[model samples]
Target: MDYFDPAGFCKVGDEAGFRNLRAAELKHGRVAMMAALGASVQHYVQFPGFDEVPTGIGAVTTAPGSYGFAALFLVSGVLELALWTEDPKKEPGNFGDPLNLGQYDIDMRNKELNNGRFAMFSIVGIIAAELFTGKDGIDQIGLDTPTL
Candidate 1:
């Protein structure tokens, strides 16, 4: 139920986190750390319950908007991992099961499992984006309906 404090998370930059990485790198390091922590923490703590609802000022003032996207990707990553693990039909050669190429038929479960790896790619992309975008830049990405 606790939210991440951007200021507190970013304190690493002002302290002893990345001394050699340039100013921008240090800032991005803090942002990446905050984004990852915020996403994982918020996903398990508030996902499915508060994701669709608005943050009543207290939450918004505490965690930045990037946390929201991070939460999204975090949930997505979890779901993907779940999908990957839940299916027993998934195998190394079944990667094309989703293609439905004649005998290949089209296994939705296998497809879902395959997508788990793709989802990981997305998670990495989310982290990289957060590093470049900072705390509030996720809002400007156009999904700006504002949930929290």
Candidate 2:
């Protein structure tokens, strides 16, 4: 019943395996954070021509039609094959900061990892709540109400 592994479920047996796991977790967290942001933004903002698109889950289901899915698949494949090829010598998620965004210390890295993990859970909860309640995140949490 360790603080980090209360279930004893983390079975990474070696450093290399742990690095790979961290990299995967980081990548998934980044995607989840973006998805959660996109879902929230969709409630308040949309492109000019996309007015007909429904909000919430309907928007996710409808906007990405067959062609969109195909394009996404192809582009994702290219990026994964070309850009995301991992380097074993590099640190787990240290795919260099291109913007020269100042120092990236261990503290910053841990914060990013923790935030990403939280976001992963958040996105899942958001989708589940929307599915069960039939309401967007804002309405689901009563944020739609206005008070004076």
Candidate 3:
């Protein structure tokens, strides 16, 4: 499957398509978007057979693969309010089913917030500390040394 491209993420951030989306969808916009994205990942995790795995990526097995999952629960919490907030054309009730949260608007607002590019990156900062504490001298002991 194709992953999201940051380069083209702006394509969805148009005036007409996402005009005042923050004001309209508010917090629900991000939540709705995340629900959709999360569902996609879940699909990949559940049905990662030959047809599901992408071409040239080799097979999808437990052979040491790394994937990242991070989203701004901040924006999602905001969006939950957005969906039911005042709208001239809409009512102040569940715009969607309580069971269905809908999909992401796929704009820069969500992408930037979800990615480490924006928001408080304290986790990244803390994890970077490991750079100075590498696995030093551990590999030099050709095999197990004798007990003292």
Candidate 4:
């Protein structure tokens, strides 16, 4: 799509403008999605033998960590909101409901957990591969003996 170049209105190193500018906004979101996906994929590899847990219950090995992280995230997020975000609790508008804080924290925490799922997968894949290759034993490691 051909469009007007807004470089005339954009200044170098203007991050806010760079992020908000029309052209930049579209590209920024795409790049952000790609980077986040890559990071999430890497995160999945952090858990070793997580899938070894049984068919039904094995999957939960990571759940507790995810849950713990989520809880911490919620608690910290609320504090951050109180510090950085507008104190809706003190505001007079209808948008400022203190009770909404808990819900918002939960919602935000869930999102974080969901986004980290990809990383969890990637990590598991790598660890499983390693174990399957006999790396799980200390006596034997890499198969780089030049043997066919």
Candidate 5:
């Protein structure tokens, strides 16, 4: 997985240079997969109660913001990962017509980027709503702390 360490890569200056290079690429991919797995696990761990969806709109706004945040992360991650491609020709069948190439067409790329922006904005709004109902200034509009 040594992308920068010159000495870490397989012997690539000899007759088997191509093989060594391929081997190095495979190693790098393995390292990447392991890193992504760790990150994904961490992301899931942050949301302890994902299965419990609130019954209504008020319940949704008050029942731990982590629920919505986690859902957004999971959904967007799936969409982005599905669109990932280092080689356009080898993209999966579900990605759409291969004729409209460029690894990912502008429309697909925009969708991925916009999903991320939407998630960020949604999280910010969630936090702002939480803050508004916190013990400081502001009205008691949020259900996070109902007087009853």
Candidate 6:
């Protein structure tokens, strides 16, 4: 636990609290990584009818109207409540590797945690850059804006 929380900012005192914190960190990191990927991907690829949707934060609002958001909420709720509910007996973030990549060693896990932390910061930076500059991530980096 010290390896992940050396500064003790999490204020985790016990093993259960540390496990919970680890789970939360893993979830946030996964989300951040996906968000970072989406931020970059949206600039290049958009759905069939969403070509006119402005990239970056604006795209979130154009998510197929209210139904899209509601459906997403429903699906996420199901996933959270049914599929990935926490089990005290299991190790934190030990959700099975469906693909069976077999990279669950300590070194790999540490690498993933580090990468996730970096990704969380990166997504925040990307969103901030987009908000300030009014450009998607790809455009902000001076990449040629490809026609949709």
Best by lDDT: 6
By lDDT, rank the candidates, best first. 6, 2, 1, 5, 4, 3
Provide the TM-score for each candidate, comma-separated. Answer: 0.30, 0.81, 0.20, 0.22, 0.24, 0.86
Please identify model 2 stretches exceeding 4 Å from their true place: 1-13, 63-73, 145-148
Off by over 4 Å in 4: 1-44, 47-62, 86-148
Arrange candidates, best TM-score first: 6, 2, 1, 5, 4, 3
Candidate 1 residue lDDT tens string, 1-148: 0122355544444432322222233233434555544544443345554454333223443445457657867986785466533222443223344655556434643444345435545446655665566532334254444243
lDDT of 2 by residue, 39-146 (tens): 787777766756666667777567543344467669978987899877888877777878898767778877888889899999999999999999988788776643
Candidate models: Cα lDDT each: 0.43, 0.75, 0.35, 0.41, 0.42, 0.80
- Which one wins by lDDT: 2 or 6? 6
Backbone clashes, each candidate: 0, 0, 6, 8, 0, 0
Write the residue-wise lDDT of candidate 4 on 43-118 in tens digits: 2333453333221112233564555456756886786467534322431111234676555344553454344445
lDDT of 3 by residue, 60-123 (tens): 2323221211134445457656644544464222244465545433453356345423222332
**What lDDT is obtained when candidate 5 is compared to the true structure?**
0.42
lDDT (0-100) at residue 48 of candidate 5?
49
Candidate 5 lDDT, 37-130, residue by residue in tens:
4322332233445435332223335556545656866885785567533333432212356686565655664454445445545444444554
Residue 137's lDDT within candidate 5 is 14
For candidate 5, the C-alpha RMSD (Å) to the true structure equals 13.1
Candidate 6 off by > 4 Å: 1-3, 6-13, 63-70
True-structure lDDT of candidate 4: 0.41
lDDT over C-alpha atoms for residue 19 of model 5: 43
Q: How close is candidate 4 to the true structure, as a TM-score?
A: 0.22
True-vs-predicted CA distance for residue 57, candidate 2, Å? 1.5
Who is ahead in TM-score, 2 or 5? 2
